[model samples]
Target chain A: MKEDYKIERVKERINYIEDVLASVAAGDIDARINSEVEDDLSGIEAAIDLLIDDLTDELKQRKKMQKEVEEKLAKIQEQQKTIFQQQSDLLELSSPVSKVWDNVLILPVIGTLDSQRTQIMMENLLEKIVETGCTISILDITGVPTVDTQVANHLLKTVTAARLLGTECIISGISPAIAQTIVHLGIDLSSINTKATLQDAMIYAMKQNQLSENVKLHSLFADSDENEE
Target chain B: MLQLTTDSNWTELGKYIIKTEHDIVQVRQLIRVHAKEMNMGIIDQTRVTTAVSELLRNMYNYGGGGEVLVETGVVDDKNALIITCADEGSGIEDLDLAMSDGYTSGMGMGYGLPGAKRLVDRFEIKSEKNIGTTVRVMKWR
Candidate 1:
């Protein structure tokens, strides 16, 4: 009779241990076999509980690391966006088209000329010409160090585009090195108006402006004379 | 487009999509940064960047869009930077005419391809009608 009773108690303890294990497997880390009576099964039950504690700690650490990595990635993306914005801002600031005279727009280009910057400068100059209805534009490249065949071609395109828009674009400040480079590259800039310095360009533009005014004045006098008749 | 088959010795630095003009600018900046990191002189850096810029512009204009892969490797026992551009656009019909200076099908002054070739140390181009075009250029540092 005592053996049968012990067998029944052992079976109940085993069933309890199975239930605790099942709960732990289902993500219930709190579940444990809290057997008060010290027996042969007690050692295994205590070991399983310690194992569960370790697993929980490991999962917590993994989650923390994941969160930290996500935060860092977000920060890097933000910084990239800021850097892109600053780059465009610099591009805008670099190409400055200002109205220096009554019918003249001057773009003083500085630094190395890349295709991107040259394209932007052309667009800005075109837009300004349309906005202000300027008759002449001076592209000062005194600060530019060099020009390859591609850059020279871009300049030619800019001049052609401006001419199409009815604005005479004068390329000013062509250093001797740049002039030699253009010739060596076999680029033909002869069709476009080029000046040695910005001062020379300004002088030529002022003269052209005066000539147009004189023509207008002459037309006005002719109209008055015909009206009197 | 054809797949880029890089040799085992080459280490790919990055790949950039060339969809818009702005992307061209960004890629140029990235190339400049990589060239600087490779300890290239300013003039060589400019040449590589400018050559890549011309290639990117051509892809954007003619191919409608493309991708460029930048790789660093040793070529002929010299440290080199390689750029590969691939596009799915209609390919060139004549290789010889396209390579010649002042022969453009588009509004460009016909300097895009030949000018790029002049700027780099080594240049290679392949194209198939209606399929695509791929250009590979290498500059030794």
Candidate 2:
């Protein structure tokens, strides 16, 4: 009778071990066999519990590592976005379209001419022209390093586009090298006005502005005199 | 005779409709972004973007408006940015004259076509009178 009772006890313990293992396999890492009495099966129960503990620890470490990696990736992406925004901001700051005179807008272009920068400069100048109703714009390129055929072509296009908007664009501060490059490339700037320096362009713009005003004033006087007659 | 060819492997990146002056600016911005993403140097970026600007201006001025397709492909085992511009305006009667420098039928400086050709690696233009015109340009990285 005692032998049968012990067998039944062992059988119950084995069934509990099977249930705990099945729970662990189903992703319940907290399941454990709490075997208290010391016996032959006790050693196996202790080993299985230790193994589950190690597996749970390992899984926790893996999750932490994954979270850390994801955070670093997100930080890198944010930095990249910031860098891009700063670059565009620099481009905008590099080209400042300002009204230097009553009817003159000056765009002082410094550094090397690239298509992107030039396009921005052109757009800004055009928008300013429309906003201020300016008739004369001086594109000062004194600080420009070089002017290839492409750069010269871009300048010409800008001037032409401005003319279409009823604004006369003057190419000022043209270095001798740029002049030579333009001529060598067979580009004709005959139709467009050119000035040796920004000072000269400014002087010309003011004079032109004064002349147009004088013409309007004279026409007004003429009309008044005719009305009096 | 200008032969029009098609490549099956070119992947389209973006498309822009050229109608207003603001559209031109937007297209230039898009080209710059794509060129930068492809790791093109600033000078090459400028050249390609400038060439596209010239083509866009031509379309806006003469063609009344058009569409530009930006694509990427492999040419001669090198990565290439391919731009295709199509216009529904009346086509040029003489392609040779139009391609010549300083031979503009309009008010441009006559440097649009030839200058654009000089700025790219490969340039192909096809036109049919009263039908339309298509210009395809490729720049290799």
Candidate 3:
């Protein structure tokens, strides 16, 4: 009968659809198609295939994008590293801040505190004190961000290293959070002098500063060379 | 969703760290741009940036020095991100000890891994003796 033939065709299409889904589940994305075979149910199968194709394309795009991103990121990170190095080098080359009175040295650290900058600060502070023949160093960190255990440690390290150099280091302008963090971390900074402000540290430094007679080569670099010429 | 898989080659030795200093503003700006390009939502962006900053600090400090990688994706209908940090110098001998808070290897305060791990939904760390180390972070939308 004509009705029996139509039902058989519909059943055949359904079987085809089931096979398509199995293929998709197996990760064979290219196995489906949008063919019109004049069956009563092929249309629905076609629609599902189209949808799967769309999702597949989108996934591909995303993967490509992720790959591109990884490449660009690697490049940027590389560039930034060079930048960090150059900055530290520059900091090393520059003069460490100094106090004219008592020949004390002051280094004002502003902005956020990280271990690297702290390390650089310590190095610069020591080198400058040594270069200037100062016995006192003042670190003014009023403009720094809140402290954490790491940052506090760097500060302590700076003080300890300075002491090894036979120099007295003063830390001034401790914010509330910083003080709290130090206490929370239980780091003992008892050895370093503390001041409420830079002005205070400077005043303290002036009183303690005494130049060695050996360092009094008044014209150490002799601009007098030009004068003689 | 983000997944962490071990890979040794990610650590780039012989590469220098170009520090811009506390140029926090500049560093933050670059991170934001990266987040947007990855199609991250505002909250996720903030978290990723913070985690990245923490990792960056580590690389800047104990990394002996190397590069960082951040990858974003979608899995199971969830938007996800994976941030990876690599270091090529002498890797940490005791990862668990290093990850412990306040257990700094140097005179440093040592919050790099712990702080970075805290910022993400999932965290994994892998390091080989004298080879390199990689810290992977994952978060979902």
Candidate 4:
């Protein structure tokens, strides 16, 4: 009778261990089989060992999936950052012209001009001159070091666009080397106002401003004195 | 319209393509100066050199030796720059695994090709088993 009782207990323990394994396979790592050896329950322990082996396989698969998902998310984030940088460069390249002084708008080109940036620059310069009602615009390139044929074409586009808006664009700060390069390339800036330096461009703008102001002031004083007479 | 032209600036990098970690600094400095002299923006310059570093790292680690052809200046009414990198190492066996993130044939954090593509406007690649690999990267101003 005792032998039969022990066998029944062993069977019950084996069932409990099976339940634990099911939970573990369903992704519950905390599940543990609580089976005690009551009068030689070797069968129950052997079954428990089998369960542990299966659980190990399940855990590894889950970990692999997690790692793959994480890697994918990281790559996506890196691509987003790149797209953001390009957009930012695009926005900055577009001129944010505020005011026109003495019928002249000065657009300072700084930083490098990639193809996209160059396209945006040409569009911005043309738009600003028309919007601001300026007849003359000076492109100061002191910050610009050199130009390739492609970049030179963009600059030419800027000049042409400005002319379409009935504004003449002045390109200033032609470093001696750049001037020689332009000459060697056989591209002419003769249609555009070329200045030796930014200082020259600024001086020219100031002179235009003063001359216009003097005329306006003179007319104002003449009208007042005539009224007094 | 895109036009093609040769730039003397290409002469400065010499014959050796960036092939190792030790070479990264020189590659970066040259890229920075070339980009700066070309008037490439601060941010583009940063992305570009960082990308170049990653590419050169792969070349050095895998190929052990290689050459890079760098073209700076504008192309076709656009400020254009192109860098072509090639290496004669034991070529990639499983390109599928190679391109996949985290599936590096070498070590940890395999994010080379993906990162390079992200940094520039255009990126292209050609590779073969037992031959070598070549990557062309371009960024316009």
Candidate 5:
């Protein structure tokens, strides 16, 4: 009778372990086999609890690493955004559009020409023309290093836009390299007035502006003479 | 290991370590000078220089920076300009897919390989899995 009671106690402990394992399998990480009952089952319970601890630690570590990587990526993205902003600002400052002469706007472009900077340049030029109502504009590319097909297209567009606003645009400072690139790209610059240097374009603009002024003066004098007569 | 196709009498025009955007610019300028010396004409100089720019950028962007060697040599008894870029980065898994136009693994226009090919007179690429990649291009004078 005493041996039978001992066997029954062992079975009860086995059933307890089975129940705890089931709970753990059902996603209860907190479930643990009671190891106080010193028996063969106690050793199994200790091993299982140790396994759960290791798995929990590993999962926590992975989560921490994931968060750290995500934070670093976000920081990199923010830095990139700031750098781009600074680049565009530099482009804007480099390609300053201003009314350097009375009734004449001048935009001196330096550095390499890309699509983005060209777009910015066009916008800035158009804005100045509208703001100052200048009838003559000069685009000086003396400092520009290279001009690709897209950049040439942007220049054409800028000239066209200026013409729509009743402004005559003159392009100057075509370096040999740029001239070669334009020819290789087969761009048609025949309609646009081009000069070898900014000084040349400025001289042309001055001559045109002064001729119109002289014409206006002559008309005004003629009107006064007619009134007197 | 890289094998040279030409004899050892090649004149080293320039060598560049491409790591950043500024380095790419330097490479382009260097090639332009060399191309000018070879009398490749202004248009061809621009084309080859642009090709170098694209290739160097690919090495920096995809290969995490690499070494580029520019040499002037004789090919088929004619003056030739040879450019080679080698990198110890993850090798391309699918070279065909990478060479195809508009096949981009990252945020790029996917014109590096094929565009460079189009700009040069001859192009070749050698890559091994986990070993690295090397690109060679030649332009005749």
Candidate 6:
């Protein structure tokens, strides 16, 4: 009868282990087997509980690590986005396209002339020309540090694109270094009008405007005089 | 419009849409972050970013804008950052001539593609006439 009682107790412990295993398989990591039962099954129950605890801890650690990585990545991305935007805004501010006079727009370009900046400069110039309907646009690159062949080509393309829109682009503020670079690169600026300084370009543009106005006035007077005759 | 074979260990860093000239700057920023993650030097970072700027500019101008996928994966047992740009605009009819320096269909400097190719360690371009164009570039760490 005592042996029979032990068998019954062992069967009960086995049943408990099966139930705990079922709970675990159902995604319950908190389930634990009874370890107080006085039998060999007690040792088995203790081992199974220890296994569950280890597995749970491992899973928790993995999840925490994954979350930390995601958060760090997000923070870095946000910081980078803001920095990039700030730099872009600074570039826009540096490449200011302003209408200094009637029918004339001036774009004062400063700093390094990367392809990206040159592209922005081109777009800003084009949009300004369209907005102000300026006939003459002056690109003053006095503050530019250096010019590579690609940068010179970008400038040439900008002038050509502006011409296509019926706006004559005058490139001024050619420093000695830039001139030397242009010569070394064998870039032809003869087809496009260029000036030494921003002041010279402005004066030339004003004079041309005055000349055209005078011609228009003279034609009007000539037509009136002919009518009077 | 473009797809890369998935590796179990590959991780996507970011994805950006190139729709305007300003977006090029954003692409540079994205690349900078990934390059930094890979511990790339300043010069290599600049070179890769310059290539990205040119390629993105081409996407905006010729491809009518598209999307770029940036990811980190193993190439030849070395960690690499791969960038792929795809567009569904009017495709390049003459791929060879288009890739050549001083060839342009619009009011561009005509040096964008060739210059970009020179800047990257690995560059590949595929296009179908009237279909689209896709460019892939990789910088290894």
Q: Pick the candidate with the highest TM-score.
A: 1
lDDT: worst 10-residue window of model 2 chain A: A177-186
lDDT by residue (tens digit), candidate 5, A1-229 = 9999989988887798788878877867787764886766688879988887777678779989999999999999999999989976897787789898889999998866655677888899889999998999999988866554335657888899999999999999997766765654345689899999989988899999899999999999999999999
In model 2, pairs of residues that clash are none
lDDT of 2 at B61: 76
Which residue pairs clash within candidate 3?
A: A81-B17, A81-B18, A82-B18, A83-B18, A83-B19, A84-B18, A84-B19, A85-B19, A150-B109
TM-score against truth, every candidate: 0.67, 0.47, 0.43, 0.45, 0.56, 0.51
- Candidate rank order under DockQ: 1, 5, 3, 6, 2, 4
> Runs in model 6 with CA error above 4 Å?
A1-8, A60-96, A109-134, A141-166, A173-190, A196-200, A206-229, B1-141
TM-score ranking, best first:
1, 5, 6, 2, 4, 3
Better of 2 and 4 by TM-score: 2
lDDT of 4 by residue, A193-222 (tens): 789987787778778778878999999999
Ranking by lDDT: 1, 2, 6, 5, 4, 3
Q: Give the fraction of native contacts in model 5.
A: 0.07
Worst 10 residues of 3 chain A by lDDT: A209-218
> Residue by residue across B35-117, what tens digits does model 6's lDDT show?
87789976567667667766777788788999998988998898888898988888888989988877888866566777677
Q: Give candidate 5's TM-score.
A: 0.56
Which run of 10 residues does model 2 chain B get worst, by summed lDDT? Answer: B1-10
B1-141: candidate 3 lDDT, tens digit per residue: 122464433332122232543543345446656666667766556556666666666665666545556556654456565566677767778888988876887656666567657656788787777777777777775
**lDDT tens string, model 5, B54-137?**
677677777888899999898778789999988777878899998887677875556567767877888889887777788988
lDDT digits (tens) for residues B95-121 of candidate 4: 767666545676424556665576678
Give the lowest summed-lDDT range of ten residues in model 1 chain B.
B41-50
Residue B67 displacement in candidate 4 (angstroms):
12
TM-score of chain A of each: 0.66, 0.64, 0.53, 0.58, 0.70, 0.64
Q: Is candidate 1 or candidate 2 better by DockQ?
A: 1
**Please, what are the lDDT tens digits per residue for candidate 1 over residues A1-229?**
9999999999998899899889988988888887798878889888888988898899889999999999999999999999999988999899999999999999999876667788999999999999999999999988875465556777888888999999999999987645654553346789999999999999999999999999999999999999999
Native contacts present in each candidate (fraction): 0.04, 0.00, 0.13, 0.00, 0.07, 0.04
Per-residue lDDT for A146-172 in model 2, tens only? 454446767888999999999999989
Second chain only: TM-score per model? Answer: 0.96, 0.95, 0.72, 0.81, 0.92, 0.90
